[model samples]
Target: MLESYLQVAEVMFMQVRLKAFIIFCVYTCAKFLVKRKCEFKPFKMLCEFGWILTVLLILKITGITTGDFGTTSVFDGNVQISFNISIENFSIATLLNLILFIPFGFFSAGVLKKLRSKWIYGILIGLIFSLTVEFLQTFIGRFVELEDVLMNTMGAFIGYEIMVLVIKLKDRMKMGALKVE
Candidate 1:
């Protein structure tokens, strides 16, 4: 079972990587063309691209792209919704769901300069994204679990906090270097 799970994960990872590569190529070409017409910071553009990739990866991982959505009715009997909050129910899937959204939060915090200081917005974004993904999963013949939503939100919050901490440390280091000079 573990081997099968790993195989599925590997396949999913490859699919997402291929899609990301294609997106990167197109984004690069677009950026090149747009750069000539407007002035935008490369860092901000990269951060925004990262967030887009993160969202695509999440969709792919959740079987949204690969599932039999065409045949599966949204109200099908197979569409399971679990509100299981028990820690004993934890599995590798739970961990992956949590890890998956970290990039979502990180890129969101990095790209939204005005919301950088507002940690609540990062959490809200995470929550909304997770909620949307779970809702869509019902149509894709995947289980929609409340636990997954909660874990994803927590992961986003953690990612946001890490980005904030990094910025603060960078500012302090710059200040210290200036003082030393």
Candidate 2:
């Protein structure tokens, strides 16, 4: 079972990476040709990829709606009422859901640069994105849990905080350099 889980994870990871690469390439080309900005920034590309992968993984983790759907079938549409406490449930899936949105917030603010200045935009986008995923899951005959939404938003907030810290640190370093000069 663990091996199968790992295999599935590997496949998902590959798919996410491929999609991210395509998006990055398209954006890079557009920026280079349209804006005439051709700076070689490897870290920026990596951050973009990470953000894309994180969003995809979050969707996959939360939206489990692919299956038979009917009143009698197992895919009966439902909304989850209870929260899964990690301490009591001891489930990795729950933990994964909680941490899934961090990259969405972190990479959005960290790499997008525009979003870094307006951090609320990233947080709002993350919330709306997670809400949409949950809403879609409900329509597809899956259980949408409020707990998942809360956890996802919390993860995004954590990521946003991390970005803020990094930015502040970078600014301080620059200030220190100016003083030394």
Candidate 3:
């Protein structure tokens, strides 16, 4: 009981400090891939992030942060197996995991212009940023698996790439229609 409480406290500390940097790094990457000027709503990104974090916070407080929150894993000889999630849970939790990184990706691509296109740089920064968070979480009794870090980073990269593809396609279509006209 005492250990759990201590862990919670530590996780809370890491969450508060590391979340912002990770968002910033991801946003930088996202900008390179997304050129659509959301000039109309400058605060949209901030508001969106705020809402996500707030909702997640509520869920965390309510003890529903993640589907794999309370499961134990055992090493069976050469492999490790987890007993925390059901089939339904596996889907929801994995979906949640992917969704969790979307905002960070958006911020990196759409907001921070300095780190755009240079995906290697952006990903490295994000990875280091995430690693720090995971390290902090580890001491706090949170799941500090590298797989989560890899997934989050991959999600950010994929989201950024998708944005880039969208922008390029939009530009191409506009050009093609202009040529025909």
- Computed on alpha carbons, the lDDT of every model, listed in order, comes to 0.80, 0.70, 0.52
TM-score sort, best first:
1, 2, 3
TM-score of 3: 0.46
Steric collisions counted per model = 0, 0, 10
What does candidate 3's lDDT look like per residue over 1-181, in tens digits? 5467547745754664456446644764576459755344444466445434533442353234443432232222322323344444444445445555554565555545555667674576456645655544433345555565665666656655655565568679989999999
Which ranges in model 3 have alpha carbons more than 4 Å from their true place?
Answer: 1-95, 169-181
- Summed over model 2, clashes come to 0
Task: In model 2, state the lDDT of residue 86.
Answer: 48
Candidate 3's displacement at residue 171, Å, is 4.9
Sorted by lDDT (best first), the order is 1, 2, 3
| Ten-residue stretch with the least lDDT total in model 1 | 68-77
Evaluated with lDDT, which candidate comes out highest? 1
Could you list the CA RMSD of all candidates, in the order they appear?
3.1, 4.1, 11.1
Off by over 4 Å in 2: 1-7, 63-91, 117-122
The true-versus-predicted C-alpha distance at residue 50 of model 1, in Å, is 2.9
lDDT of 3 at 90: 44
lDDT of 2: 0.70
What TM-score does candidate 1 reach?
0.78
Candidate 1, clashing residue pairs? Answer: none
TM-score, each model?
Answer: 0.78, 0.73, 0.46
